[model samples]
Target: MITKITKFITPALLTLCFAISLNSCKDKPKKESTIVEEKVVYPSDIIPFMDEFKILCGDGKSYNDLVDVKHDNFFYVENDGTTDWVVYKSPNSGVTSRTSSNTRTELGQKKEWLPDTGGKLTGTLKVMHVSTSGDARVAASYAVVVGQIHGTEGHENEPLKIFYKKFPGHTKGSVYWNYEINTEGDNSKRWDYSTAVWGYDMSVIGDTPTSYPEEPKDGITLGEEFSYEINVYKGIMYLTFKSEGHETKTFTKSLIKTDFGKSKELPEQIKTLYASIGRDGSERENAYAGELQNFKQGAYNQTNGKDPEENMVWHTGSETYDGDINKQYKKGCYTEVWFKEATVGAGTPPEE
Candidate 1:
């Protein structure tokens, strides 16, 4: 979603980037359903720890405050002055809410927000509605999974920054905008998305996908068909804002549990899989390894090691031995999670 959607932006707001596991049967349905082990510090505990970093957008003085996560909150607040903040949560992604009051509006991208592509703004705009004098009649919009969000309303609200290399020959209110966050922190999750098709110019550089059904003749453009990758289980939650909720897509990955208790040593291995990060270059791995502590996309695994971000100090806790991405990869995904962790006290940089 991040890659496919963000192409609607100025090329500075987008990011794209990965899988798997297997296991056995045996009605071992206990582990996946439970947040059974380890102490999950409530939002109250998570807020102060998260305060060390400057906010890129929105205002949340504390964790319990309006931290509408993933931009998934479906609060039906009219675009009036009272629609100050969005605070909501999703089971698969975790908790996050942010303030959208007139006081918290940010006009442009943060200086720190940079795309890996030659210092360009990320994503694109699929639609735009601006006044002839230069002001946004409507704020920028975005979606996270099933959720939709509008930019902090204010200013000349110019349709100025709106752009997309995709969706050419479009005039007036025919374009859309997209914003995407990445797994700057977690490793356990991934999103199915693309950065091709639908855009005006289908000349997307780098490894263009050949397997897509609507394979554009030139390179891939950004629109309904462009795709990319995203590991959303932590790190950054990319916001793909389309024009007036135009880019609302969904990814329903119904995960099944596998049996990892079959082996003696696998228990320890599974523990690492759960408590640490996943995928070698996975964002979660980087955050768990404490390498991504400075980035905005939060990390998910906060156990069994030096605190990543959140000041989530490690503490011994009961482990949940469900078939993690590891077992899912082995059996279903046909991939392997080569787990790694820091030595007792040796500092290390993550290597893919």
Candidate 2:
């Protein structure tokens, strides 16, 4: 009886020890997980001049303080493996400025001044993309305005519009500038005169809505780097364009005086380009003189969904996806520009 009792007791003791060991292992502490987060970069980090201007995004969002601000798709910073760039992007159709119909993800200078007490702006940038779907016959299609001088008074007309336009199925595009006349009477009759910096002017367009003109021989390709300087000193505007393997072009214009004051001064290009729209009005004699003006830079999308038949000059009939920015970007129906460097300041006299 005693031997049987000892065997049973030994077995129970072994079971009890096993249960205690399992509970002890379960109570042991676990090692905590370590997660690392990436640091976010802002547009202001790439361009320190964000404090000097305000931004209007393509989605109608406006920001007065850009020091640590960034809009997701419209304004942001991108890295090209080697360097970081401040990107300005806009869709073909979106909320626009009250004074214009086009969309823009652009910066507006905070300070305004007259032509006599002038200002200056410089930028080194590259256009990454323009709207791919549009009417080829329309001058504004597949184009974007990268920089401009906009008046704050009178008709609030644009004095200068530097453009980069590329037709579909073409690898090369034109770099040009347009000067909009401050109409003498009705602002609705104002027109822009385009001048080429590298290739064809804005007047060079396709004959049909789909047909494209010949690809420019001496034109700028997408992603190509270029620099521009707009210096308005003592009521005179001086423009300089520079790029590698391209001609360094320079121009001078008077902001105080009108070059298109007389009807006879209108070029043949204007007559032909504007004849369809009946825009035959001349500019005011004083032009933008005494009017408060400001500088603007970024992607001002000229392409739109408006029918070309309605307004042959300004309309593009591009695909908008009903103002869906994501769809527009995925389908290449947007304008994108990258600026590596830019500066804004009081204008100084050019080297004599």
Candidate 3:
């Protein structure tokens, strides 16, 4: 009897020990996750050039390290079902660069290049919105610069400013580019030479402050996809504009010398467009040949809240609500651009 009882007690003890071992294992911390964490997207992920550039946002926010970071309204990443895009947005009135009246949530290439040495910058984007409130007579009204090559040393003028402009009730807008003159005497005498990329150039504006011209048949509509290449190779700037359902345009400019230095060189568009504004200054004899210049891409707000009567060409009489960002965005007093792709690097030699 004693042997049988010992056997049964031993079996019962073994069962109890097994039960305790299972309970201890259940209490142990988990080493592997059962649910995977979702991957986070960033603006830098959308625009890979951020590694070589720094961003200045409209709210005076400057960002150098943006690998996985983003600002809310000024600089952020947006996803439209399939593809991700980096959005550069700015209010009509806000803190801006010291030399500019416009506010920009734009990227500035940390690398600088000379006109002779050359560089290449490309952008594929669409303009979503531009400020609606502004004096129609103002040249800059209802316009926003999307990309530019800005000089840094001399007058800090821009050699190229790609723009998209539309009137208040227009069904389509104009896609144009301008070359700001590197002035000869003072920087105040500087002006830009407008060139039409697709539709009308910057010169096509309302006859009066409120009257608008007939819409262009080939004008770019808001949210239309377009691409531009500012390729300065061997001191020659080659521009290529591409879009679906529209003609592809290519242009070449000699950056090593001036093409519009004399008053006679000014295009008829410039004379007529800038007639009342008094901006007939000639470009430097050499233009932006050797100036330290850099690439800037994004929404550079051309419209502002300043009194238009003061400087009708630039001073836009737009509604700003005194630089109130929330109000500006709500009322569409802002410029918004979405860049799905961009590249900045050395310019390659054109094919022989």
Candidate 4:
């Protein structure tokens, strides 16, 4: 009887201890989890001068306040390992400014000034990508305008436009600038005269719709770093372009004087380039004089879906996917530019 009682009591005690252990576990508190959120970096943070300007996106969205602001896939800050760059991206087809048909994800200066009261703009950037699909014969195809001095009054034309163009299947591209003539009469008759910096001018094109010209010998490649300074002082425009391996180029032009005032003054390149389009209008005597102007910087996408036959100089027969931004980006039908540094202020005298 004693042995039986001990066995039964022992078994009961074991069962009681097991139940107590389970109950204790149920009464105990649980450890809370800790979650950490990442801090977001904005374009304004990278480029502190963003507050000085306004932005016009490729989708026609305009923003006056850019502090801590960012637009995904269009205007944003990107980290390329060591440095943070402000990326300006736009599709081949999207909402464009009222004055032009090309779409841009670009910044416009809020302060306007005249040619006499000049300003300076500088940028250190790299052309990451240009539209891959476009008619090779079209001058504007596979190209983008990276900088400009745009007029706000008079004919509201662009006095200066810095362009980067690379044909399909070419490893390198051209860097050039165009000066649009302030037409003496109708604005529709205005035309641009292009000058090359590192490669061929806007007049160079392929023989056929798809054929590409020879690769430029000293052309700039994608992801190459280049710097440009636009200094306007005392009605004179000074341009300086510098790259690591290539030659540094400097140009001077007078903003108050007209170089193409008469039809006879039209350059042979312009005459040949615009002959097909019939835009041989001469510029006014006072070119951009007294006109309110501002600086613009970013990816001004030159590629479009317009028929090349209509306007060979401006039209680009590129794939648009019916104005879809995502589809165009996915298929490389867009332009992307990355700027590491930029500044805008009063123009200073050029170094003698």
Candidate 5:
């Protein structure tokens, strides 16, 4: 009778221990739910072109490795809630290119080509800001250069300089392109011929710094989306400008030769625009033909902190504070631009 009772007590004790172990397992805390947030993609992540080009930032820093990388102030990525844009910003008084009195946060293509072989470059962008301080009588006042095709060899002149300019107290700005003259004899006599595609030319400015012009009813505003294609093929460069709610304008120019070889052949617009600056020279017979050229796209600020009296046309009397980036940008002496998409490649032949 005692042995049977012991057997029963042992079985009951084992079952009790098993039940206690199960309750302990159930009381343990579960792992906290992992929450993963999405990462913000940058401009280089969207358009990786580190292998094809080099970047010159507004801070005077050159970047050869740009893939998935960005600079804090000069070059960075901005997301406007719906779209991510590549921003190129430059202060008016910072370090600049050797040939011009401008600063840029722009891309320089690694490859070069001649007019005969040709090349194509396209960009969809908008001008966010330009220097707000400048003399109205100056041509570069309140203006920013957004794109260019610069010659790498020879005179190292620029074949194209696209600009977006707005006057103070105006609601809309102008979209124009300039063709720099390849001087036949003296480079000092060189000038740029501006052609308006959407609004007024560079010459349309106020009589004084305080005076104002009528707002362009059919012009582009700040942060408006616009695009340009510089396609050079078969010795001719074809340009296409497009923006929503505006006319799609197309233009063609001969890169192999100039149509304004003589003063008499110069377009009347050039005389009116360059008269104040004393630019009366004509382009060469063969314009930019056979010259090694490359594409440049980004914010090439036309404004500067120099004295307005030195060179009224290109020298802007904006606030530079001796190359202080913080002071320049805060004082509205800076240019900022954003690009959505871009491509660079060989020019495609048009179908006959």
Candidate 6:
């Protein structure tokens, strides 16, 4: 009986040893799990932002014509400031939703903005847009390059932001616009929303700004840019820009009179009406010879510096504008014009 008891005790001791060994292994910290979680941003989602970047550069649309689609990354917030997530291209890359990642504007911060990470490239647009305008009026100077975006990395075009469209009071190095463009897989459609838009020049009613102090007679005008709403319900696509010394143009994209199809001329009344706005060569005196006039007639540059007609876009002054009257008829500077019906372009106009 004693020997049998000993044999059983021996087996028990061995089992105990195995149990501890397994526990030791289990207690070992996992190395892989300790790694930081980075978001996986997709190229497709980021690429459309290129379109926003391009539109401001020289595309034939107003700044309002800018739209975006965003792609959100998987994020996990910890008690500490550290945020972890798999890096993936987000939806609406070009559309600014007031995310710290998209635009860093303190004017109107957006909901669900991950402040820690978003304060990067995507953040510049929002913050810069408002601040530049404000600074322009107070200081009566053009805001210098606050900085560049997406520089020399995944998106090479990031550096091109240095040339973003400039407003009247805002100069070339001073111009800025933040867009968190959320794209809907289809290139044809886009949504613009989550705006904390602000401007420096809070001018009076009916007062529009003109050119920048340093507006070069030689270069182009990146006049008032536009921002559209994501929902069709919101008309007057928010048209924001420096209104010279007056109220920073916090106007809406009023395309109510704008027809969907291209017009024979800038239309009849539109021409004389804008002239009353006090725009010089920036806006066409006759609607027939306006911004579209150059393109329709093949006047813009095609080969070398020559227009399709061999006329340089600069020589025409039909493109850019500056200063307090920036909101005036600056050519190439995009704004929403109301049309009776929708006949052309990618998206349908909002119902009147």
lDDT of 1 by residue, 1-352 (tens): 8876666663544222101112333434556565668643222132322222222222222232323222212111111242222222111111224322111111122222111110111221111111111001111111111111122222111111112221112231122222221233331331111222123211121121111122223322222322222212222223223223234433211011112112213234223323333322222221111122112221111111112232111121112123132332232211000101100111122122
Candidate 6: C-alpha RMSD after superposition: 18.2
* lDDT for residue 62 in candidate 2, whole number 0-100: 96
Q: Which window of ten consecutive residues has the lowest lDDT sum in model 4?
A: 262-271
Cα RMSD of all models vs. native, in order, equals 32.9, 4.1, 4.0, 3.0, 3.9, 18.2
Clashes counted in candidate 2 amount to 0
- lDDT tens per residue, model 3, 97-213: 898888899889899999889999999998999988888878799999998998899888888999999988997899998888888897776777788987788777776778888
Stretches > 4 Å off in candidate 5: 1-40
| Candidate 4 lDDT tens digits, 1-352 | 9999998899899999999999999999998998999888888887778988999999888899999999999999898999999999999999988888889999999999999999999999999999999988888999999999999998999999999999988889999999998889897788998999999999999888999889999999999999999999989999999999999999998888899998456799988888888888888888989899999999999999999999887888899999999999999999999999998999999999
Alpha-carbon TM-score of each model against the true structure: 0.18, 0.90, 0.88, 0.91, 0.88, 0.24
Q: Among these predicted structures, which one has the highest TM-score? A: 4
Q: What is the lDDT of residue 200 in candidate 2?
A: 90
lDDT of every model, 2 decimals: 0.21, 0.93, 0.87, 0.93, 0.85, 0.23
Q: How accurate is candidate 3 locally (lDDT)?
A: 0.87
- Give a tens-digit lDDT track for model 6, residues 1-352: 9999999999999999999999999999887856788864332232233222211211212232223322222111111133221111111111222211121101111111111112112211111221122112222112222222221211112111122223445343223322212121331221111112232211111122233444333222332322222111112233233323323424332212222123323334223322333221221112111111000000011001111122111111222222212332122222211101111112224344
Model 1 clash tally, residue pairs: 78
For candidate 6, give the lDDT. 0.23
Error of 4 at 230 (Å): 0.6
In candidate 6, stretches whose alpha carbon ends up further than 4 angstroms from where it belongs are: 1-36, 41-352
lDDT of 1 at 146: 14
Model 4 clash tally? 0
> Compared with the true structure, what per-residue lDDT tens digits does model 5 show for residues 32-147?
99999988676777666656888888888997867777888988888888988899999887777687678889889989999999999899998999888888878888888888
